[model samples]
Target: MREVQPVATAHLRRDETGHRRRVRRLPLVAVGALVAATAVALPQFTPDAKAATTLRGYADGRGVKIGAAVGDGPLTSDSGHTAVLDREFNSVTAENAMKWDALEPTRGSFNWAAADRLVAHASAHNQGVRGHTLAWYAQLPSWLKNGNFSASELNTILKGHIGTKVGRYKGKVYAWDVVNEAFSGDGSMRGSLWPTKLGTGYIANALRWAHAADPAANLKRFSDLGLEVSVTELDVRIPLPASSAQQSADYKPASLNPNE
Candidate 1:
């Protein structure tokens, strides 16, 4: 039997305005399902005649890549988790170390210790790095959220944050989730502080700034529950509920024509 510990429901249940939120649970359920599916779908074969090999080895043999999310604590520590990560994955994503709150708790002050550790580990292991995010509405520092800055000030802040983070990891990170979870279930832009203040074009501006920072890195929009799609030349819409059925039904394959 699996031992389940009690989780703090307060933070997960309430939104920024102290309102009861049900949407948060959907992503958790979707993630659980995705994990189970991935475990069952993983190939159980050796790529070569080597004595011991891993999923990364098999993927490398077939010109495919496999990656996993790794927290800074485990990646920086001497433990089995780090050992397995180094051996089994060809890429690593920082679970939280690269987020807005984690990376910049105060204005103009950056914390790269945790993020740098993960990048170094990936580099030493001969793996690529996927910058988890450059723009996210959630988990932002209170200072930024409550700064009451003007539109021009906020634009400068946003661009500065993206340029600093992405520029630091240029060429090191092969891909970046330039913007995350910017849309709702019905394919409309979500009303976060960013859109509330910066307008919907914030997504485009973010991608542009990230590209400017790292022209070599692949800029991507990461949706919840494995609904990632490339936003290199088009605006992609991801549906909510994050289930395979809902995703298939609402996820349009064609990108929206910007001119239209």
Candidate 2:
């Protein structure tokens, strides 16, 4: 949820021409799954004097949902930020609260206070909650990262983690970024503990564990294992004090197709 200037695009379900489009910059491989049942976060818009409706309202009219990556601190403490979220977003993503480290700081001990708060807030606001992630290399607890374990031990640990986390909010979550950032920009599998220890097959195992934990969620089919494709963290940055024309010009849409 790094805030960048100018433009941001969420998962676009269909293009302007009414063709169904899916965004996947990389091949649907071992480590990533995009669940399309829920809507991803849209661009955060500021209040405008000439605006006709809220962002959620506009998206609702088009049969789409607009959401925001909500942080617990601002969501709970900042009234204005919460107000905007309530008013403009129909879905909320737990930016950091749902991450592995945030969920479980110490091995065998989990602190779900923050994540629960976010989910409760979303429920109260009639918003869908998108679980940020289940398996990821970064933001890992010290124990999980530093522990010296055999491949079998690590695999067991991973399965247990996924089952526990996803099971906690089985039906509550709209979708889960089950595995994230598993590839580098060049489309090669990124080096991480998972591949180093558990091998690339760990990704498929993680997905299976997650599905077993909560089969009712993430039921969309885009490829094997009922996973979809998404453009996670889409953003555009332009020079400050830029005009609308410049923003439009800079934010050229890419020709994307998950089938490709």
Candidate 3:
């Protein structure tokens, strides 16, 4: 069985004015129902040039110790011997997730070529690629700043943005950040282009739409600069990593183990 992931409830269930607050949060979506869960790789732990030699030595005789998230760029089609490097360490990540100004400077338009190239390269060599994010308070288009629109119009905008992005990669993207950051430490939802107009439902709506766009995509929510976002929508308790230390025991840390 796949392991349950930790939730962000502690951050959401905080005290207010010296009293307990009844802040409710959404749970994780039924990931297994929609798709087989994707396993997240631990971040790179070593950066030494000789780290490879150390690892090689381990593989050669010492032991078979290898990191899960190890990666490098442009090795698939490198003119130099970098292609060989990619073949050796095939896992890589997308970097331009923070550069929204270059991605979608205009409303309803996207420049996915740069990212697509990376995903294509990784897929060609039988590797995995992660979509860094779907939404962030920072790195957003100025057009989205306090934009005026009806709720229906706002939902359409959000749907278009997420659907296009999530659909473009489809199965190529092993995982996706369906909704990046949508809450504050005080258990309040983050006000953004969607929430400001579409309110709380925007979160679930985004997840639902993205799930349909790519059923095989693994859904992940992040906030507070890389912290997992766990919300309890309706009754689904997505166990996200805690955003802070103020949570109750019900929201405990859980492992997201690989599928059996």
Q: Which numbered prediction scores highest in lDDT against the true structure?
A: 2
Across 123-158, the per-residue lDDT of candidate 1 in tens digits comes to 777776667676676878889999999888999999
Best by TM-score: 2
Model 2 CA lDDT for position 3: 24
Greater TM-score among 2 and 3 belongs to 2
Clash count per candidate: 0, 0, 17
RMSD of each: 14.6, 12.1, 14.3
* Off by more than 4 A, model 1: 1-48, 51-53, 217-260
Q: Per-residue lDDT of 1-260 in model 2, one digit per residue for the tens?
A: 22221212243121222322223222235336644333333233344543338776675555454567766677767788788788777777776777778778888889898899998888777777766777776778788889988999999989998899888887777677777768865568889888899888887787778778876644443444434344445435555797887676556555654233
lDDT of 2 at 252: 56
| Candidate 1 TM-score over all chains jointly | 0.66
Candidate 3 lDDT for residue 155: 78
- Per-residue error (Å), model 1, residue 57: 1.4
